[model samples]
Target: MGFFQRFFKKVEEVNNQEAAASELESELYVESPEEEAMNLWVEIAQNILVNSVRATGNSVDRAFVLVEMREQPSFDIFYQKDGDLVMWYELEDPAIKERIENELLPQAPSVASAVNGNFAEIGQPEITFAQLQFEWATKAWFSHIIREDDAHAKLAKDEVLHNWFNNLSTEIKTQQLDSDTKLSWYP
Candidate 1:
């Protein structure tokens, strides 16, 4: 009887240990705040991108979402979700293009050097690389309200990106950048 009692106790202890280990493992896979933020932005980008592709009445082109982080400044850019590399200028946002020219192009060299490593140092970093790679990546997505043509149907699902951006908390974003971390996103 005594031996059986000791055996049962040991079994219980082992089960408890296994349960704790499982809990810890699950916690390890949980997304960090930065990852969560990236995901949210990615989702928004995807929604817009899908709608934009429909505007062309064309097939999928190459698409991506890139997050560029540096010490002084950071940027989150969304490429059209379709990854076929089609010429998709129908949805290009001119205001965004202008802002990129004024703000991002000038500081691109430093950012490029940091992100691309030695390749950026070969010569003056091509601001066009940054423009084409990051800022211009999102040109494919057109807002429903902003469209001038009747080709695309107005969908209520399209998020006004500027309004979405305004709603993001700057404090939380700054905190996320504190870690020596880089974050990007996809579905």
Candidate 2:
């Protein structure tokens, strides 16, 4: 198969896996405190992406998490369809930028593979909150990478990012329900 064909096949495989898992989750879901907190974080993360896209009119290509630092994670959104530098987002926060370069970005292989007009090779994404982060990524259809980390929390409670997300409770609640419906498969 050609490169594009293989890429599409991989994407289809991922989608099918998600659909099956969602169907299983719907059958087995039981609400608890842990699940509530997890759902909250997922809402906040989604708001961050939705608000960002609304503000800039750009679709996110991928989001990278910084394993070493507990500060804000980084997202690479598409800016120009044809440009030399179309992948980078200029975050106003210098601290976040420094952390991304040092902690999250994967060291490039000598010869990078070009897939979908972008360099698709990167290390696994480190997760602070597995359920929320993964749900957000899956909902957005955004590819993520998780690097192995011993110190990260099961659910990220970064107050700074939470405050930054700052979406209204009603908005988040509605979003949460929408996300759940989309991600959960019901018979």
Candidate 3:
């Protein structure tokens, strides 16, 4: 299959999986805290993207976490969605950035893949809210990379992007999320 075709196929698969899981949830009448947490982050990320898109005419092409230095014992992590040419930074701790670069980034792809493949893996009973948010962010970041080539698949992708951003906003607001939600950043 062509790149765009494969990308759309993957998106459809993901949507189907999510739909099936939701149906199962309704049948089982189960509400997991971890699932709630994951949903929360997704909403937050969506919101950030929506606002950015509204302010600018560009779609979100990349999303990732960053670490910074300039504060003592401080760290930040954030998601970048669609927007006009803008660079934003979160996590202001040098140590945090170093740790993420050395540790988190390497583990991110696998973790994201796993979560995307099976969202339930992350819905562990013991999973903390913080951890869930991190996982969601990681997955979202990776999703951006995998879907990068498919951004223009159809006008529907644009709608999906808008919907994703809006959902992320809801997640952020509902969860009282934070991570230096900045509009511009410098390395």
lDDT of each: 0.32, 0.33, 0.34
Q: What's the best-to-worst order under lDDT?
A: 3, 2, 1
Cα lDDT tens digits for candidate 3, 1-187: 2334445555666587844433433333344656554554454445433333333223233342321111111112334343321223333445544554454434434433433333445543211111112222222322121121232322232343344445555554434223433222110
lDDT tens per residue, model 2, 86-149: 2234644465445444533432121011110121122322333221122223444322222225
Clashing pairs in 1: 61-82, 61-83, 61-84, 61-85, 62-83, 62-84, 62-85, 63-83
Tens digits of per-residue lDDT, candidate 1, 32-135, equal 44444334434443543443333333333322222222332233333332322222332365654454445543443454344334223343221111111211
TM-score of 3: 0.25
CA RMSD for every model?
A: 20.4, 19.3, 17.4
Report the poorest 10 consecutive residues by lDDT, candidate 1.
126-135
Worst 10 residues of 3 by lDDT: 67-76
- Candidate 3 lDDT at 86 equals 22
Give residue 135's error in model 1 in angstroms: 18
